[model samples]
Target: MENLNRSMKLSLEFGLSGAVLLPVIYEVYANISTSIGLFLVAAFACFAGVKFSALKFREAFVGITCTIAYSGILGWVCYLFIHPRVVDMLLKRSVYFSLDIRQQLYFLLYCFIILACIYLIWLVRFGLHKAMEKFKSNSEKTGSYIENAFDDGKDDENL
Candidate 1:
């Protein structure tokens, strides 16, 4: 049972890591200029992740640093694939008061990425809270069952 719970938690973390990368991937596909913004956001994510992971600063700092490095590598790969098209588009077009197709696409992508990240963070927190409550209840029930079983065994022995 404990192993099952551990595996579930590991799966949840894997899902979250994939979810977090979706925005970064989408932004790369839609617009390369936004890659810089994505990297900065990712850095912030690392810091936020550490803060929210509920670990001591000393332990979390390393995790946050590692997260930043991982994000940077992902950002680099994304840039490699998407930068040329974005650069070409920018070169061919001039700035205007109205948003162009590329600009609009970038805007929409940015919004979606932000929303997805926020939602994932919220979901993770909610899941953790519920898991803690369930663990507490299960622990109490187990403790009571053990106590009752021991008492019953002692009564039988006396009789």
Candidate 2:
């Protein structure tokens, strides 16, 4: 039950983050390519997922997946409905392009790569944290040994 609740919370966090950020980012960079804008949206979604989940890798992954799914749905809706109207209003002209299968594939590929990179970064950070812990422990041991040696030398001199 607790796990279910946690998952739901994470999913909502991801979905909302993706949904809200996508439009804002597109509005800000109106002239940018769709792919670049989506990439930025994905990056922010990932960041928000990780941040809001208390930096838990598994939870962040769940969040990211939810974010992508929600964003895709919202994007499709916008493309089908909101986009044409906005374009018509702004340009007073209609533009049409045939669907390019390659572009769709490339977009998916890029999204996969971005997600993979984020996970890799998390792994590296975890590794560095472990390494720092080991180094700190070794340094403490060395410090204690040096202090013990100094104490022994003082004892010998007093004797």
Candidate 3:
């Protein structure tokens, strides 16, 4: 039930998620010098979290979980599909042990997909919440708690 439909909240979530997972991915899977990017993203996440209205901690928790889960899954997939190529690339005794252009692009694509999945998960949650809100609001607006289903214009003097 996060208000992740808002742009600011979504951005904050993305920043925080990226800041957390990018460094981990760099250490675990590939080395891409994410320190500066992590710092910037984390700083923005902090700023946004401070400037915006505070949501329940569950929102942050869920976002972190989503990011971690997505990253973990992506990691395994990459390990299966891309790690072999990277290992082969590195074992070639080239001047640079870094990833090739295609490898770099694949790594970037994986990172982007993880972050995007986090947003997509939260978007689905927000959509469901909005739909329930609309349903509840429609009922509340169209109905009343009063016992009377119909009322005459005249006030009963006999009461």
Candidate 4:
């Protein structure tokens, strides 16, 4: 139960972050190139969530996946429901885009790409984590040959 709560919190944090950014970026550009901005937000949120969180391997990935999907949904909701004009305009846009099979396929391709990116993020984060642990272990085994001035008056046994 604790793990689930933590996982949900993590998901909400990153999901909201990306969700908040997506529409603003889309609103600002309102063009196809805005896709790049959305992708950047997704990558940033994923990478940050993966690298910074202390959750285990499976949990981290689960949270990140949830975050991605949740954010996409929330961003759409925000973009559409924010204003009546936007709701109508975006509905029209969606209808126009939905008629194209190619665009639908492209959407699937983008989903696959997002998953691939999350996997890669996990790989890099896991590698760095292992490397840091190894470095700390090795460092602990090796110490300075000379004592510092702070230990000058300390002795192992005097009585």
Residue 43's lDDT within candidate 4 is 62
**Backbone clashes counted, model 3:** 0
What ranges in model 4 sit over 4 Å off? 1-3, 29-43, 50-53, 83-116, 141-159
TM-score of 2: 0.59
Which pairs of residues clash in candidate 4, taking residues 3 or more apart in a chain or in different chains? Answer: none
Full-model lDDT, candidate 2: 0.58
Of 1 and 4, which scores higher on lDDT?
4
88-121: candidate 3 lDDT, tens digit per residue: 6656854324567886576566555544444444
* Model 4 Cα lDDT, one tens digit per residue, 1-159: 676678778788867876666555544334345477457655665675565356677777777778778778886787565434544677787631222566544544554466447657776778788899999887765544333434655565553
Residue-level lDDT for 70 in candidate 2: 73
Best by lDDT: 4
| Tens-digit lDDT track of model 2 for 2-71 | 5545755766765655555554444333544675767685676457544434445565566556656776
Please give the ranking of all candidate structures by lDDT, highest first, separated by commas. 4, 2, 1, 3
Name every residue pair that clashes in candidate 3.
none
Best by TM-score: 2
Provide the lowest-lDDT 10-residue window in model 1.
56-65
- Which ranges of candidate 3 are over 4 A from the true structure? 1-17, 31-99, 142-147, 150-159
- lDDT value, candidate 1, whole model: 0.51
